[model samples]
Every structure is written in structure tokens, then in C-alpha cells.
Target: MKKETGRPTQLITRKFAKELHSNFMKYRASIIAKYIKKEDANAVWFSVEELENYIHYIKSKGEKTGYDVNGIRIYFGVYPEQRKYAEKAGLMTVFLQATGKKIRKAAKEGEVQTLALVMDNGDGDISSIEPMNYGSIGRPPSLLY
Candidate 1:
């Protein structure tokens, strides 16, 4: 009788297991990146109240640092749960409520030029820009989107 060639059932060593685990992690990261990009491209504008709730949600979900960029206080690196909540809330409502006062002030001052709405993945990567303007042209950039 001839011996049959079959798959070996053996335990993987620690080094190999670690490498495999690392590869899986990288793959997961890539998937997350793609999802973030898609979400960013489809990001909506949120209100001040919504934004505040989102910030709170982010804090609850394990966000540690908040970034202040060009007068825009951005809360990033929120946990998956927080991000999901924000997404469910949508951009239009959340951001609009969050920055309602600012938007109103800009309108009153006639300094609102454009509003750029953006969303990011938890991994330090951003996706898109949704721009909204108050007037037709030549307005100063006093808006933070």
C-alpha cells in the first residue's frame, strides 16, 4: 500500500503565529481605512448641539486628545462605538447644531465664506470635504467647517 499525501496537522510556532497575527492586524487596518474613506466622502454637516454630543460620545468611547486646527477644535481618534454613533447621527444635524452659534455669528458679520465638513477614521486619516458658502463671492474665510 502507498501512503497518501494529506495536510499536516501541526502546531504553529510562536514566531510564525506572531507574524500571522501581525498580518491579520494590518489587514483589519486596511479595511478600516477603506470604510473611513467612504464615510468621509459622504460626510454631512452637523449642528453645534450634535457636535457637542458627538464630542461627549467620543470621550466616552476612549478618545484621549482633541486637536485644535486653525480655530476648529477637532475631536479625533474616537473609539469604534463613538464613531458609529456620530455616523448614525449624521453630519448635517450634528455639525449644524454644534457650530450653530458660530454659523449664526458668521452670517451676521457677513464673514462666512465657506464651510467644510469632514470626517475621519480612528486611525489618523481623513476622507473628504463638503463645502457650504454663505454668500456668492469674495467673502473672508471666517468659517470653520
Candidate 2:
């Protein structure tokens, strides 16, 4: 099958990952730490299964849009700064967005369709959706389409 014009998956080297992870740690401690919970001031990670299943769900839900389900938008997000949402208050995170062409093609249709794979708005908890990993960051950069 032919591919469509959209995001492309990217791969990074372990050396590069290490450098990036180091940068993240520095940046988090210097800037993001104060705004978020102490425990949350590290990394936000999603397992391979979690991501793959979400992609499957997105494709299934969109149901053969012909737009080609081969891209995604990972948006930087922040938990609302409120007492009620204290566990995630002002925390920085990323959202893995729509991969279905129906959702991606919305850009061409004058409006963009977004599907943030967060628990409040996705199916199957997406592997617990936001299981923030409190560890080092950086990995081979994967630009999935």
C-alpha cells in the first residue's frame, strides 16, 4: 500500500537518547519541578503495548477513512492547576493524538480532529493512560505515522 503525506516515524540512536534524557532531567529540575508534584517531576512514559493498542483503537474507531492511518500528533499537555486535580496539578505531559486518517485529514477539511489518548477521553485506559514513569527520559525518537 502507498503511504500518505503526514507524520513519519523516526528512530534515534541510544547515544542520542542518552543526551536527550540528560537534557530533560536538567530542564525538569530547573524549571518543571516546582510546578508539578515532586514525584511527577521526572518523565512521562507509555509502553509499546499501550501505544500500539491505542493506535489500533483509533484505526478501528475511525473505520477505514481512506485517509490512511499513519501519523500522529504528540502534544505537550499540562494537568490543570487545581487542588482537586492535585495528583497531576500543573504537571507536564504529552498526549499521543489521532493516527487515523479521518482524524488526520480533518486538517485538510478546514478543521482538525484530535484524539488525546488520555483516560478521560479514550477507550481501555490506554494501559492506564497516564502512568507517569518516574525515571530517566530519552529514547530512540519514534516519529510514528
Candidate 3:
């Protein structure tokens, strides 16, 4: 008569439970990060070529933004969702740009975020150069982006 013990279990105490939860979150995040691409999880990925094509398409339809350039193009005017976001921020409009030549030129070195382009033939693509906080005109030093 001997009693046998199998595998040992971690006793989840209040303090140990907190540590266990924190460690589990870290481990889970690491596992998920290994499987997820940064762009896939956080942002939309579009190519320069795609943008160029979209620009050409819009231009063909006579839709142009004031910021169209060889590499960068921007479409003005607020869309329904964008308008909602802007309204939430108490803004009448949110000037947008793609991370192209014009956007780089407009944004102070780091103010620009990744450009998001959503294609639409009817209203043209929706392009947003985020952290939309810049001006377009000023002396040689303060032009908007």
C-alpha cells in the first residue's frame, strides 16, 4: 500500500495568480506576434504601383486631389466613415495623404503615418495620411502636408 502522486499542479495563490496571469498574457502575446505580421495586424499594405494605378484611374475620370504627384496622391473631401471620425474629433474635415512624395514633403519629418488607400471606382479611392495634423501653406518652412 503505497499512494501514488501523478503530475504536480501550480497552486494559484492571490500573488502567484497575478504573476501567472501577467506571464500568460506575455506568453500569449509572444505566440500571437510570432504568427502575425506587423502590417497584417496593424495597417493596410498597398504598393506604390497600386497607388499609381489608382491615381491614373481617378485622373482618367477627372477626379484629382490637390496633392497628386508622381509617387504620392491625395484625395480630398470627407467620406461617411471619415466624416464620422472627424466629427467625433470635432473636425469639419480631415486632410489626408498617402505616404508619397507630397506627403513626405508636407509632413514635418515624422508627423506622417502610414497611408491607407481603399479603392473605389465610384467615389475614387479613400486615402488617408494619418495623424492628420499639418498645414498646407506657409513661408518656406511651414507648408502643410
Candidate 4:
């Protein structure tokens, strides 16, 4: 079979999308209720358009910085109460990618870091690509709610 070089739309699935959204709502409801005002309605998920645009931007920016551009780490975030946006304390997404050599070194050194990266074993098996889900905090731009 010929390897299709373009992005694979065949991989998309509505079933999982709905399931993940439902799961997020189920698990995240309390946190949203506590952190965001009732009117704020913290978002359960982000639109694909927003996510795709951000991914494209990451790829472009990563190439400019001369990195192999292996991955993007999306962190969950919220605007603080003092934030002027309507999404204050609402869901936000922070996109992190391989920026510079310094970040890679920090990951390798295993030092205590809030700003840190984890490099895969140099053996080339990217086991991290396996299905797993998680998030961390950040400030808001596009609110999830």
C-alpha cells in the first residue's frame, strides 16, 4: 500500500470526541463551578479550528527555530479573577512546543523545574506518543467556556 503523505482525516472519530467532552464535563464540573462564575460557563473543550490553527503555527515557528518539532504540550489554563476577560477562571489552553536547546537540556538534567521538558530516550522509541491525557495551568487567551 502506498503511504499517504498528507494529514489523515481517516483518523478522526466523533465517538471519541463526544466521549471525551462528556468525560470532561463529568470530571471537571466541580472545578469549573468553584473557579468560574455560573455565567462564565467554563468550556469543556476547544474547537478543532482553534486547535488546528495553533498546531500549524507551532510547526511554522518550530521550523524557524531549527528544531525537529516532535510534539506540542497543551496545558489547561484559566484566567485569574482579576482578569478582565469574560472567561476569567474559565478554561484556557496553553500550547508549548520545542523552542530552544535550553529547554531540552533542562528536561535531560532532571532538575526541579516548573518550566521543563522531557526528552524521550535517545533510542528513538517515542513511547510517550501512546494514548495518555493530562493538563496543567496557564493564563487565558481564547476561553474554553
Q: Could you tell which candidate, 1 or 2, scores higher by lDDT?
A: 2
After superposition, the stretches of candidate 2 with alpha carbons farther than 4 Å from their true spots are 1-9, 27-29, 34-40, 64-67, 100-145
Pairwise TM-score winner, candidates 1 and 4: 4
CA lDDT of each candidate?
Answer: 0.34, 0.50, 0.37, 0.45
Residue-pair clash count for candidate 1 = 19
Give the true-structure RMSD of model 4. 11.5
Estimate TM-scores for all models.
0.18, 0.51, 0.19, 0.43
Compose the digit string of candidate 2's lDDT tens values, residues 119-142: 122222222222322222333222
- What tens-digit string does per-residue lDDT give for candidate 1 at 66-140? 321121233322224445554332211112111111111123244577544342323321112222211111122
* Model 1 root-mean-square deviation: 24.3
Per-candidate clashes come to: 19, 4, 3, 2
Q: Which candidate gets the maximum TM-score versus the true structure?
A: 2
Off by over 4 Å in 3: 1-40, 63-145
TM-score of 4: 0.43
Better of 1 and 4 by lDDT: 4
Candidate 3's residue-wise lDDT over 39-105, tens digit each? 1111123456655565565443333443333333333332243554432222112243433222212
Q: Which ten residues in a row have the lowest lDDT in candidate 1?
A: 96-105
Ranking by TM-score: 2, 4, 3, 1
Cα RMSD of all models vs. native, in order, equals 24.3, 12.0, 24.2, 11.5
